[model samples]
Target: MALKRKKAYESNIEKINGARMTIETQMMAIENANVNLETMGAMRAGAEAMKNIHGSMNIDKVDETMDDIRDQMDIANEISEAISRPVGVGDDLDEDELLNELEELEQEELDAKMLETPSPVVTAPNVPVHVPAARANEVEDDEEAELRALQASMAM
Candidate 1:
């Protein structure tokens, strides 16, 4: 009986994990769809502008297409805005603060992902190295030399 209960619990956990994975995948898809919708809106606007310039445009057709594009753009904007809406309670905070926090969170998440992935070790090019003439000829003035000496003495 105990073993059967354990097995059932494990199965339930697996189901929950699978559901979570599905939700994450769906959210990523939604983000991509939002981007595509915005691109589509821009393309429609460009096409409408071109049609107007060509002077072969049908007023009714243009109006209908613009309206449809506007509706779709609004829907995409709303979805994107909803996705970006803050999860925590902070009604009193200013917009800048909220934006800053969101930026920081995004940076931290990016950093975590970077830490997870191993970067490739790139070797320097095997070309002949040429030392710059300016660097080789550079000399420190008395004041700069004194400052460096002081710094070295202090370090010692």
Candidate 2:
């Protein structure tokens, strides 16, 4: 009697395992169907939107509008180029003449400044009054200071 009861329990376990496998397979099928329905809905919505857009558009009018835009853009570019070009910048003109005149003016100003600088006065004995060494921060002239600096550097 105990051996028969053990065999019955073993058969019941096998049947339960088969039922669990069937339920798992059914769940997988339901999940796949849900994914397929969502994909089809999305595809249908996209198709409907595209159909509405196509119904509203005329291809010939679109082409004409694009051509007009391109023509306007071309005209605008031409106008921009014309406006940006420098006026009177002819190949016959010498641009260096203006630079040369500026340089000459600078040289003239330098000469005038040099002529304006006063020379130190000398007494009848021709003795030079010396500046104190401690008060020697005053520059007599930039050219003389530069000359002394050059000489000192060359000596070194």
For all predicted structures, in order, the TM-scores are 0.30, 0.50
lDDT of each: 0.91, 0.90
lDDT of 1: 0.91
**Per-residue lDDT tens digits of candidate 2, residues 1-61?**
8999999999999999999999999999999999999999999999999999988789998
Clashing pairs in 1: none
Cand. 1 TM to true fold: 0.30
Ten consecutive residues with minimal summed lDDT in candidate 1?
134-143
RMSD of 1: 36.1
**Candidate 2 all-Cα RMSD:** 15.9
Residue 23's C-alpha lDDT in candidate 2? 97
Cα lDDT of candidate 2 equals 0.90
Best by lDDT: 1
Best by TM-score: 2
